[model samples]
Target: MTTITTRTVEYPADNLTMIGYLALPAGAERRPAVLIGPEGTGLSDVERRRAEALAELGYVALAFDLHGGRYLEEPEEMLARCMPLLADPDRMRGIGHAALDVLRAEPRADPDRTAAIGYGTGGAVALELGRDGVDLHAIATVNALTTGRPGEAARIRCPVWAGVGSEDPIMPPAQRVAFTEEMQAAGVDWRLVVYGGALHAFHHPSVDHTVRPGVGYHPRHAQRAWRDVVALLAECLPVTD
Candidate 1:
């Protein structure tokens, strides 16, 4: 196994102090970087572990914060915060760019070779970054099949890949179609993967709470989604030794 290091990173965004996690590989050489966004519940061990795993794969990864270090356990609270943020592209871009700044500041991060992968609300942020023309190598999101404002997706210059549970109520078929249509209209190099028999947040194993209807974990699908994401990164943002 490759050696990796992790540390807490605190930055300002949305007029709040955002605490994030940064993971780096063993060597000092600059490498492809990844901006990891957490779900609406905020940054947790799930995202931190993901950053570490990416570091092990030779990429500098930063799991940036979403809610000023607050983790929302209640479904209502999470929805209240995320819904508005999703509707406001400028705010989402601000949050994403703040963390992108942190990631680029790292000595081991190759700014030009960066990608963004996120989950849920975090995924939406990743999409917003691409829409804002951040010059990402790739943009990948899970359980965040949401459409952007009209004509904004044209600014996305990289390959976009999204995965969602077929049964996800939040991202139902209509929403998926809208998202795909937006991407298609923009002429983006995009792909969407639907995991059958899975629901919203299927990649999250520890979220056992019945926070809402049609949301649960599917362990097998979770693994498959991760493998797919890794493949997308390899194709679009390969890291060299």
Candidate 2:
């Protein structure tokens, strides 16, 4: 008997009433709340399930829609809405913090054990949240690039993990290599895994864009990545075992 519900949150910063779904595990006390960010395509049904899965694993998971319910059909259109936030990372941090606030404020969610995960451009937003010096327990990202902004890598105060597709052109391997190096140099506790034969949208199963070369699906990678995320949250979130 999972106590899950969905709601629309009106963030005061941008006056954006972002629709968010929350899933609460049954009988859980002082549970961790994970703020999940939608992909570049926005909050698809698949993302919802992913959040629910996290919720099933003894967490209060809240998946937020970054696009205000107007999902675009093309990458360009998605970029239009995502770019402005990217240009001024402060605003991006606002969105993540706002969503996180909404999650912690939930009756079933314990603010003490909070974390975040994101996909695609949304991953960038999650990173911004981490860089904003918020007190987060853990942060996980998929298919996201390193922002490389000065003073950012030094701001993370929690365990971090990232999943990348080996052949993801958008998040090229070389760049990931550099990102790892930076994380190492910063002495940040981070884990990065590259799925050997996967592409950019490996975690997104509802896509048929795999027909295009160097872009597609990896059911195996997706499953593994999803499992890894759950494991990370369980391991990182505040819990007394």
Candidate 3:
């Protein structure tokens, strides 16, 4: 088995010190890298594990924090912090850029061959990075399909892929249409996949009692989404052997 290393990294963003989890694959040669953004509940073991998994697949992965090192188990707290942050594109860009800086600084990361993938509120952050004109090969998001300001998406030069649950009220059909229209108007290479019968956050595992209303897990769809994400990375930012 290929060796993998994990560590805690600290950086500054949005006027706050943020803690991120980084995973590196074995070998000294530089490889493609990915920046991972967690759900609105903040960075948790879920995102950390995803980073490690990516490292195992021969890519450097960094799962950055959203709320300093705290994980919000309470729905209200998560919304209170995420809603406002999502509304401010500048703030979201700041957070994404901070983490991207850390990832690019890694010796094993190929700065020019990088991608961004996020979940929930973190997904919006990833989209913001693409909209802010960050040079990335690909961008992927799940369960967070928010549309950006007029003409701003044109700044995104990378191909984008987004996945959401078809029944998710948070990202309803209308919202999905709007997001796709924005991508279309921007002339971006984009694709959207709606997992049938799935709910919001279907990619997320159950966290305590946080499962409520339109939010729950669909194990089958979750695995499929991960595979789709991996495929996206392979197509856009492949790590050659």
TM-score leader: 3
Give residue 31's lDDT in candidate 1 (0 to 100).
Answer: 97
Judging by lDDT, tell me the better candidate of 1 and 3: 3
Whichever of 1 and 2 has more TM-score, that candidate is 1
Q: Spell out the clash pairs found in candidate 1.
A: none
* Model 2, CA-based lDDT: 0.78
Candidate 2 weakest lDDT stretch, 10 residues: 206-215
Model 3 lDDT per residue over 1-241, tens place: 5599999999999888899999999988999999999989999888999999999888999999999888888889988999999999999999999999999999989999999999988999999999999999999999989999899999999999999999999999999999999999999999999999999989888753396799989999999999999999989988798
Relative to the true structure, candidate 1 reaches a TM of: 0.97
Full candidate order by TM-score, most accurate first: 3, 1, 2
What TM-score would every model get versus the actual structure?
A: 0.97, 0.90, 0.98
Task: Evaluate residue 102 in candidate 1 and report its C-alpha lDDT on the 0 to 100 scale.
Answer: 95
Candidate lDDT values, in order:
0.93, 0.78, 0.94
Q: Tell me model 1's lDDT, rounded to 2 decimals.
A: 0.93
Q: Judge candidate 3 against the unseen true structure and give its global Cα lDDT, from 0 to 1.
A: 0.94
Which ranges of candidate 3 are over 4 A from the true structure?
none
TM-score of 3: 0.98
